[model samples]
Target: MDILADIATTVLSQLQKPTLAFLLGGMMLAALGSKLEVPTPVYKFVVLLLLLKVGLGAGISIREADLVSLAVPAAAAALTGIAIVLLGSRSLARLRGVSPMDGMATVGLFGAVSASTLAAAMAMLDADGIAYEGFIGALYPFMDIAALVTAILMAKMAQARSRNVIPQNGAATMALGGTGSADNDGPSENRTLVRGILTDTLQSGAISALLLGIAIGVLGRPEAVYASFYEPLFRGLLSILMLVMGMEAWSRLSELRKVAHAYVLYGLSAPLVHGAIGFGLGMIAHQLTGFSAGGIVLLAVMAASSSDISGPPTMRGALPEANPSAYVGASTGLGTPVAILSIPLWIWLADLFIGL
Candidate 1:
C-alpha cells in the first residue's frame, strides 16, 4: 500500500501533465462530432457506478474522525463551490460581454469541479496510506448538469433580447437535457437542475454505497458485507472508472485550441478563485468542528479545491462558434496540471497556519 501510494503521489507530482494530454485527446474526438461507440448496457450502470463511487469515496478517506469533525464544513465547502462556479462565473461572463451560449458554458465550467482531477489526488493519497482519497466525491456530475441548465436559461435570455423569443421556461424545455444559463432561470431550468442533482444523488453509485453503509450501520455486518459484496466490487469499479475517465478527458481536451482567446482568463482565474473559496470554507469548517488534527483539518478546508477534469466537456459544449477554441483549450488543458500543485500546496499552507 505504501509503495502504491508513493507511486501515485509521484504521478501526481510528475506524470499529471502528460496524463491530461492523453485524457483530453480522447474526449475531444467524441465531443467534436466523433461517433464513439459505447455499449448500451454499460451507460446506465456507469451512471450508477459514478454516483456510488462518490459516496463510498467519502467513506473510504473520511474517517470517523473526519465525519464527526468535518462533515458540515465539507458540505458548506461543496455548496460554496456550486455557487461560485454557477452564479459567480455567470456574472463574470456577462461583464465580459460574452454571448449567452458562451456565458452559460463559462458558468457551468466554473460551477462543475472535475472528477478526474480528484481521481489523481486520490491515487496519490491512497498509495501512501494518507488516505484523503474519497473526499473528491464532492466533485460530482451534478455540477455540470446544473451549470448546463443555467447555460440554457442564459441562452433563452439572449434570444429574448436579440429576437424577442421569450421561450417559456416550461416543462417541455425543462425536459430538454442541456441548456446553459445563469439568468432567465425559468421553471424548466429549475426543474432540470433539480432532476439532474436528484439523479446524481439517488441514481449514482454513491447512493448505492450510502445505502450499504446505512444497511451495515443498522445490521452490524461491516466486515461480512463489506468484504463479501462491496469491497472487491468498489475497488474494481474504481480502477476501471479512473482508467476510462483518463481516456475520455484526453479525448475532450483535443479541441480546446479552436475556441476563443478569453478562455485563457478562465483557465487562470477559476482555480485561484475556487481554491481560495475552498480554503476559506475549510477554515470555517475547522474552526467550528471537533477534528483535532490540524493537518487533516487543513486538508479538509481545501475540500472545495476539486478535480479539474470538468473544464473541457462542460466548457466545450457551452462556448459559441465565434469564440476561438484556444481559450477553452488553454483553460481545460491546464486544469490537471494546476491541481497537481494546488492541492498539496494548500494542504501545507493550511497546516502552517492551523496546525500545532
Candidate 2:
C-alpha cells in the first residue's frame, strides 16, 4: 500500500515538472488540432545542445572517475541492449502479422538509446535531488551501438538462413572469409555490411554530437563555458525538445493503425519489461560497483527509450525491405510516450528499493 502510494505521488509530482508538463502540453496541443510546430532546424539544434550538455557533464565526471567502477555498469548496459533485442526478436518479431525484418527493426529502435528520454530522466533525478555518477551518460554509445549492431547482424543471419546459402556459423565464416568457396563473395559482402552499419551509427548526428562534446570535455577544460552556457540552457532547451517530441508522438499515432495489434501490445509493454531488466542488471552492477540509485533509474530509462533520432535512418539503410510504418509507427506512436511517462515509476522504484 505504501509502495502504491509512493508511486502515485511520484507520478503526480513528475507530471508537474516542466520537462513532463511541456511534453504533456505538446501532446494536448496536437490532440486539440493546434497547428503549432517547432521548426525542424530549431528542433535539431535543441537536440545537439542537449546532447552536448549531457556529454560534457559525463566527460568531466569520467575524467575523475575510477575506471574499475565504471566497467561493471558499462558491461551491464551493453548486455541489457543485446538482451532487449534478442528478447524482442524471439517474441515480438515472431508475432502474427509481423514480418521478421520489420520486427527486428522495431526492436532495434527500442534497443537503442533516446537522447530526449535520457535528458528527461536526468532532469527528473536532479529535481528529486537524486545523485548519480557523472559518467553515467557515457554509457550511451556502448548500449546503443551494441543493440543496433546485434539487431542488424541477427536480421542478416536470419536472412542468410532463409536463403539456405549460409548456415548459422557460416555468417561468421562469411565475415572472416575462412574455408569458404574462394569464388564466394559472401565474406566481402558480410564485412562491408558490418562496416557500413558501424560507420553510419558513429556518423549519425546524435551520436556524433555527444561523442564530440565528450572528446572536447575530456581533452580541453570547458568547465567555464560549460557552466556558463550549456548549464543554464539545458532545461529550457529540453523543455522545447520535449514539446516537439510530444507533438511528434501524437502525429505518429495514425501510422500505428496500419500495423498489427501485436505491435501495439509490444509498444505498450516492452518499455516496462525492458526497463525492469535494466533495473535488475543495474542492481547487480550496484552490488559489484556500488552504482547509485539515480544511475540505476537512468539505466532503466535508457532501456525503456526508443531511438527516434538514430535508429530510423540506420534501419532504413540496413533493412530497406522492412516496413517503415510498422517499426516507426510503433516506436514514435506508443513506445516513446510510454517510456517518458514511466520515468517517474523507475525513479520511485529505485529510491524505494535501492535507496540513495
For all candidates in order, the CA lDDT equals: 0.47, 0.89
For residues 222-319, write the lDDT of model 2, one tens digit per residue: 99999999999999999999999999989998888888899999999999999999999999988888998999999999999999998899999888
Cα error of candidate 1 at position 200, Å: 7.8
Candidate 1 residue spans exceeding 4 A from truth: 1-54, 57-71, 86-92, 95-98, 128-254, 291-332
- TM-scores for the candidates: 0.57, 0.95
lDDT of 2 at 337: 91
Q: Candidate 1 on 243-293: residue-level lDDT in tens?
A: 455444455366554554455556555666666665666566666764333
Against the true structure, whose TM-score is highest? 2
The Cα error of candidate 2 at residue 311, in Å, is 0.9
